[model samples]
Target: MFDVEFVVDIINKSGSSVEVKLDDQAKKFSQIGLDSLDMFNVFIELQDATGKEFSDDIVENLVSISTIVEFLNS
Candidate 1:
């Protein structure tokens, strides 16, 4: 099962909130305050927690918590 709490914990560790606004949600990776390194760490944490490997394309497409939840569920 997808651990939503684990995802949230990773995100929070980056000093960002899950309650992002809709407009902010549509922003690109660079504008979202999460650098490439942050993403790499998140991916590592996710893989460790979920035992699932996420590709670069999939990581790029994950815009929101709900989307992540769906990804994990799928």
Candidate 2:
């Protein structure tokens, strides 16, 4: 199961240039200063760590940390 802290850790470990400090679980990746490339890298890192694939189609819907956590947990 995934949590906000785990998601935040993954984003930080993703090698994204932006620093990760998530106060709101509902905060979108864009609002956190992640560009498309950063998002891609973050997803890849998440897949690698969690052994879960993030399909392209559904990636658009996973805009926030809370959403990602819910998806992973589900």
Candidate 3:
């Protein structure tokens, strides 16, 4: 299950120690020190984990941890 905690763990383990909670819906990725390249890697990892391919539009709108989880759920 690719939930917020899972995502946060992945992000933190990936070298950025970003702390995220369930209510961080309005927070942007950059505010947590997540750069473009870092996000790109996370996107790839998420795809592999979920076995789902996200389109360019979905990737573009993934501005926050909430958005990422929403997209995964969608």
Candidate 4:
């Protein structure tokens, strides 16, 4: 059920200063101005929203909305 729009919504609501959009799906988190803490919060929010947990290995590669959507659907 996870999609780019869903991911973008969560990212935007995760308290990050930067606002993410569907066009930014291929962009890196850092390129969008998301710091470590922002990413941490995003992940936590994502886990809570999706009712799914990510392992360290998976989290390491989740650097973009495209990847996150792929991982979540996989």
Strongest candidate by TM-score: 4
| Off by more than 4 A, model 3 | 15-25
Can you write out model 4's per-residue Cα lDDT over 1-74, one digit (the tens) per residue? 78899999999999998988899999999998888899999999999999889889889999989999999999
- What is candidate 1's lDDT per residue for 1-74, written digit by digit as tens? 65556566666565442333434434554566667776676667778777888997898777655567679899
lDDT of 3 at 17: 42
Q: Which residue pairs does candidate 1 place in steric collision?
A: none
Q: Write the per-residue lDDT of candidate 2 for residues 1-74, one digit (tens) a residue.
A: 67899999999888897878768578887888889999999999999999998998879899988999999999
What's the lDDT for candidate 1? 0.65
Taking every candidate in turn, the Cα RMSD to the unseen true structure, in Å, is 4.4, 1.0, 2.4, 0.8
Residue by residue across 1-74, what tens digits does model 3's lDDT show?
46888766656556554555556656898876678888877777777777889788878998988887788787
Per-model TM-score on C-alpha atoms:
0.61, 0.92, 0.76, 0.95
What TM-score would you give candidate 1 relative to the actual structure? 0.61
lDDT of 3: 0.74
Clashing pairs in 4: none
- Alpha-carbon local distance difference test for all models: 0.65, 0.88, 0.74, 0.92
The better-scoring model by lDDT among 2 and 3 is 2
Superposed Cα deviation of residue 17, candidate 2 (Å): 2.0
lDDT for 61 in candidate 2 is: 96
lDDT of 2 at 9: 90
User: What's the candidate order when arranged by decreasing lDDT?
Assistant: 4, 2, 3, 1
